[model samples]
Each structure stands twice: as structure tokens, then as C-alpha cells.
Target: MSRIQLALNVDDLDSAVQFYSTLFQADPAKRKPGYANFAITDPPLKLVLIENPGHGGTLNHLGVEVESSPQVHAEIARLSQAGLFTEEQIATTCCFATQDKVWVTAPDAEPWEVYTVLSDSETFGTAPILATGEAVPDDEAIAVCCGAAENATAPGAPCCG
Candidate 1:
């Protein structure tokens, strides 16, 4: 199964969780220090809340959560074939989980990813590969989940993932 994932930045985690839970009539599937997610059944939505102070009520990133890594690989190929730049992150950790994913940016610069979670993690994020898709040293990676790749047209770029 697959579900669209929405990651939102909030100033307060507790407040956002409370409101979303009340609105959806469901609790978070996972809760961490500053992160929470809901696996909504009716609408099949993966709503994620990120405690990013001063960026309340704004989108953090967007994604589609698939069932496995093969699905992620398929998206990478499909997006690339369609002439959209693609950045593939395999076995990367983000949002307190290990994931296999591919990223792309919309015409308006909105970041989107097709991903599958492999397991939970204790870390919040890892250094995404550089704009060249090279696995540079951690010190050299750009620190944005949205992508440093937007500046370039060619495939392969950086992201906060």
C-alpha cells in the first residue's frame, strides 16, 4: 500500500499533536522529541509534524510512502525518465527512521519524495549527498530536507534527508 505523506513544521509539537489528533480522531503512530506522524486509515494519509520553531503551520516537505525499496527505485526511474531531476537516497536516515527514497522538486520549488521506511532510528537526520550526488564527507553536505539540488537542472542533488 502507498499513502501520501505530508510533513509540516510547527512551533509547538504538543499543540500540533493535540490538534491533529482531535481533528483526525487518531493518535500519532510515532512520537519523538520533536516529531510525530499519523497513519490515517480512512484517507490513507501519513501526516508528519515537525517542531520547527518560527515556521509554524508551514510545510516541511511532501512525500509518498510506499511499501518497499523497489517502489522507491521505480520512482527514481520514472521521475528521471519524465525529465524531472531525481535524487536517490538509499538507506538514509531522516525523521527518526531509516528510509529508501527519491526526491524531486516541483516547478514552484516544493520538494517531494517517494520513500519507504526500513526501520526506526534514534537520529533526526543525516547529511544528504551533495548536489553532484557524491557522498561527500559529512562536513560537506548541505543541510536542508528540501534539497540543495533545486539550484541545478541535472539529476542528483542534496536534501535534508
Candidate 2:
């Protein structure tokens, strides 16, 4: 199975690392001059952070996983139905690999990319890093919208998964 990947821009690498460590509850799998990454196995997610020279703050991009090309198309349709903005797929090469995917612009204007690999030989290079989604201010709302509500303890809403 493929993993869900996420990347974000930070103002301070050191502070971001400490904060993320508390958030992810684990040390970073890879740390560099202005970046840090974590591979979360349990949920099958990959996360990375990069220092923004001019910009400062959190809330990057969003990414979702799909199995095949058909799945990607179906998800695009589904997200469109939900009123999400999606960009057309443009054939290109990145990270030395060919990708078939679309970019999504959420209601909040955050960029989200969805892609499928035609080949895995492009695993080298800078690695396909992405931007952050779900802005910082929306963190609490995201928790609630994503079902993190503490008061949502009824049969319908489960407490903190």
C-alpha cells in the first residue's frame, strides 16, 4: 500500500521539531539543516517540514491516498461533488519520477496534491515534498470536523481516535 504524504513550511526548524515531536510523540526519522521528516507506520503517513525563508507560520497542504488511476479519478469526482476545487492533471516529472495526479485548492486556499506513481525509479533526489494544508487557526476546527470533539461522545461521534 502507498502512504499518505504531507509537508509544511516552518519559520524555525528547531522549534518546529520540538513541537512536532510532542505532536507526533516520536523523534523525527530524518533531520536536516532546515528540514525534518517523520514516517508514521501505524497510520501509513509520511510528513516533512521545510523552513520558509520569507514566510512564517503553519497550515500547509493536504494529501490523500488512492490505489490506482481509476481511484484517483473517482476521488476527484467525489471531492468536486463536495465543492472542493481541483486542478487538471498535467503530465510532468518530479523527483526523477513520472506522476499522474491532480492539484486541489481547498476552500481555505491551501494547495493539495493527489498523485499516483507510474514507476518507482524516481525515489532519489530531493524527494517529492509538499506544502501544508489545514491552516493553524483551523487546527481546533479540524479536530472537531475530523471528529476530535471531546463532547462528541455519543454513539455517532467517538472520542479521540
Top candidate, metric TM-score? 1
Q: Encode model 2's per-residue lDDT on 61-104: one tens digit a residue.
A: 55654567777787778878888766645343432334556666
Stretches of model 1 off by over 4 angstroms after superposition: 128-146, 149-161
**How far off is residue 137 in model 2, in Å?**
33
Q: Which lDDT values do the candidates have, in the order given?
A: 0.75, 0.53
Q: List clash counts for every candidate, in order.
A: 2, 5
Superposing all C-alpha atoms, what RMSD in Å does each candidate have to the true structure?
5.2, 13.1
The lDDT, on a scale of 0 to 1, for candidate 1 is: 0.75
lDDT of 1 by residue, 88-112 (tens): 7788776778888888888887888
Whose lDDT is greatest here? 1
Please list the residue runs of candidate 2 whose C-alpha ends up more than 4 Å from where it truly belongs after superposition: 1-4, 12-37, 80-84, 95-97, 119-161
Count of backbone collisions within predicted model 1: 2
